[model samples]
Target: MTNNSIAQPLEQAKSIAEKTVYSILFTISLSHLLNDMLQSLIPSIYPLVKTKYNLSFSDIGLITLTYQLTASLLQPFVGMYTDKKPKPYSLSIGMGFTLLGLMCLAVASGFYWLLLSVGLIGIGSSIFHPESSRVAHLASGGKRGLAQSIFQLGGNAGSALGPLLAALIIVRFGQGSVMWFSLFALLAIIILAYIGNWYKGAIIPKTKVEKVQVEKHPFSARRVSISLGILIVLIFSKYFYLASMTSYYTFYLIDKFHLSVQSSQIHLFIFLGAVAAGTMAGGPLGDRFGRKYIIWISILGVAPFTMMLPYANLYWTTILSMIIGLIISSAFSAILVYAQELMPGKVGMIAGLFFGFAFGMGGLGSAVLGKLADSTSINYVFHVCAYLPLIGILTAFLPNLEVKRKKIA
Candidate 1:
């Protein structure tokens, strides 16, 4: 072959390899938005369901437990399996489960049936998150933090939308209106299938030279393990406090401020909107500065606002809640990207572990705090949860993983 011929293909391949697959990233992000919007329906309708079923706080807690348990328990295993054997089409299949769950929820005649519906939706979430996260990683083009943040921003945006949607639809029209949301799941399935095709084709065979340059971790295995444990503690702290807000904040507003359910949901929407906004900032900042510093400021910096939350008046409560959401929401993308860096070549497993632990903590926290709220009051729940952010102090113990750029062939 002529030298010019050889150079042409080499340059073409390099150009293709080097460019970020933003189309795929945005598509996957849209799917994430759909998936989480559907998932958020469960919490968004809690007050409606509680009133419909005459549920006690403990019952409400159990419902969250059931949904969260199903979502949490299987993520790591799903992630591990897919890491070894990529499942490009599984994302669509998971959305099918969510679609069915939504249908079931629409007609749920009793609380147990409601549990079954949410459990199915949780299973769908478990299947969706880890693999979709892997898709985001593949399309990152070495900008992992930015990609993750974009991906997570969709979900947060969807989460913000759910309460507003529920207020407009379910709360006004009644539970049967939940069936309308299955359209989102169907749309997600179609998008994910298209993304799956892209994923399948995008898996170019790795060259041996490319494999050899992948960086090895500098830390001992023991140190990495300990670092992971600390991250888990941070996840626990973040999610538990979030659980109180997501699961019970409406009740707090109703009890303390005498706000209508619709009004409280709007407030929840505002907080979640702040979260979506914060999520966008974290990834790019982590990419520029370093994930550890982002993690530190995100987790610890929110403590003062959380502490003040219990004492704030209605206007101040609204302001503080948004501030809390903005600060705390930044940690996850940074933390997830950081963990992926710590355990190189285990992106799926790490994503699964952290997402799974986060769901588990939120579930457990909801259940525990539900009982606490019943025993004491909703105000007490907020007062106790305000301190959970103090666990952010553990961020000091995590060893920094330096970001190293790798050349793509």
Candidate 2:
């Protein structure tokens, strides 16, 4: 009853755990691909949106705000709920809303509807990262870093694929076709959900959860707020550069660098590819090297290379863009991990803000930078962006971090 019986059950539990992790990772990866298409394709569609809507600079910026702001505001609440409950249902619910948003977007009649649709998409995105990440955290056991990195790479891969696929769809089919692709992705998500249900036995389940030593930092809410503030700032700074490539790089390439639309699209794809590679790489590296070091290095790398953009020729632009892509993307991995660590018990809250708010909100920064470009050289925008990472680097010195063992909760 003692030795053999215990070992048998232990081995069986380990096998089940392994299968569960593999299934979750597969599902999360597919969800990420679909989710990324929902968000990242906006940039490819920006020109179409601008032309169709006759949007002003301020309006475009606010469109970004509309999409991101709701996500940011709702994330903490969503996280709190997911933490206390089973998460796969939240994942399905989010995907359902995301699909609805995409369907609305496919036939959007006006600016208000567009904003409403994107906002809904943002809300859906808010659910996936934190909950999926928590699942990954549980499944990984002692290898959280490596596991998180692998899981996060799914997102980066999705992002990389999004722009390139959008560009192809736009070039071959038309801008409207992007919506159809999103629909296909949404269907896939539904299929994956069914698969998850069949494999796991329920979409959501009741299980006994062990009580863990939950961290109770002083003024915990305030600390979360402060961390969120710092992240928002860093996001604003980073996206000024990052979103520019997505939203307006095609325009910039054509107007400034004399590239044709097709060529500009290619360059944008290259840029997205770089970002995807960097994001995939950064997570495991962040875990191995310490998230702090990765953050500082990425920040420091930003300024000098960004400052050089104006001075460089077209070849230099390609090289520098790749370099900047590599360094700056470290933030996606490092900061996401940092924020999750910052709020250990609230993975969804952390991810919601980090992925949803910080990123979604940062969409507005593209407009600010675009406005700045109206008066100054677009190159000068990069020059300004180069220095923004210093804030992130400086924040690295703050003393509130509490790195835990493999399991966060």
Candidate 3:
């Protein structure tokens, strides 16, 4: 980097700190949509891959385990390093891996190759999430909850689209058609390049660390650690239940209702679309009220629907899934933003840790649940996962950082 450009960060940071940058927020959110849509393609195509390669449920579970672990394991380190190094162009570079993965997936001859393809995509996701999340934080102008929700909205919306797209594109045209999605990755790379340009000038350089005015939360480290643990447990409960839906909901629908793959995907799409709407509302609601209350309500509020989900008929199943999606999906944004508030200056690290933990839970959940499905039935798997959200009751133990912030002010 030139000295002239390098000297510009203080001015850029001042300019950025002045107000919320909606343009950048929307741009990064769009990139998130593209990135997650690619990642979702793997699970969305699970039925196709399972049949095409003569795979069992265990094989399907392994594919998710490989990808989720790859994505989950590296995320914290990536976030920690970038928190210090601040790589402006890394987002664009990460999308390159996704592009290659999509190309590989289109022609994957066997299950192992499919695993490799997804692993690559997982790596791309590990790199993309923490940094893109940091960009959302930087552009927030102190409205962190709103910023994160907008960012997550893109991801949730993209995830919703994946199943529908897979049904329309890959299912209709067959496995080779997966290559068509590489185009979106290519587009993301270009968009992220522009984002990188903006990011380069908008933050403090890695070569220099300025002292930041951290707002004290008036809580001890032990309390913070305890709170963090509670958050992790909540994440475990949430993602485990979600993994059941995202990974095996289609199977549940087909087996119980005797629906086509395309019809099942449409059902999944509707549920996830509700998730996207809930995600959009979550952050702003957290911003308006308190994150603690939002967290409590979001996680525990969906329990009744989940409890009833396993026993519903086709029509009630669809309605209950929508209710479950909307309520449960709202928790992540609030949880993430609350954690970020707990550790003020460690935004990237907190984001990485939470996002990583969430992914790990999801991967682990998929593997375990897949085994259960093989041994029992998809119906039984949902019946078991239905009770996981009861763990959300632990949200009560968390101290109110918002009240603390007000008092400190």
Q: Where does candidate 1 stray beyond 4 Å?
A: 1-17, 205-210, 403-409
Minimal lDDT window, size 10, model 3: 204-213
Candidate 3 lDDT, 15-86, residue by residue in tens: 557568899999999999999888888889989989989998888988999989988888899989988888
Residue-level lDDT of model 1, residues 1-409, one tens digit each, is: 8999966756665555456799989999999999999999999999999989999999999999999999999999999998788888999998999999999999999999999999999999999999999889888877899999999999999999999999989999999999999988989999999999987866553122124435777778999999999999999999999999999999999999999999999999999999988998899899898888998999899999999999999999999999999999999999999999888778789998999999999999999999999999999999999999899889888876663333211
**On TM-score, who's better, 1 or 2?**
1
User: Model 3 off-target regions past 4 Å?
Assistant: 1-15, 205-212
What is the lDDT for 70 in model 1? 91
For candidate 3, the clash count comes to 0
- Go through the candidates in order and give each one's C-alpha lDDT: 0.90, 0.66, 0.89
**Candidate 3's C-alpha lDDT?**
0.89
User: Model 2: per-residue lDDT, tens digit, 280-382?
Assistant: 6666777677776776677666788877776778888889888887778767667777776666656656665566655654666666766776777566666
Q: Count clashes in each candidate, considering only residues at least 3 apart in sequence or on different chains.
A: 0, 0, 0
Error of 2 at 161 (Å): 2.1
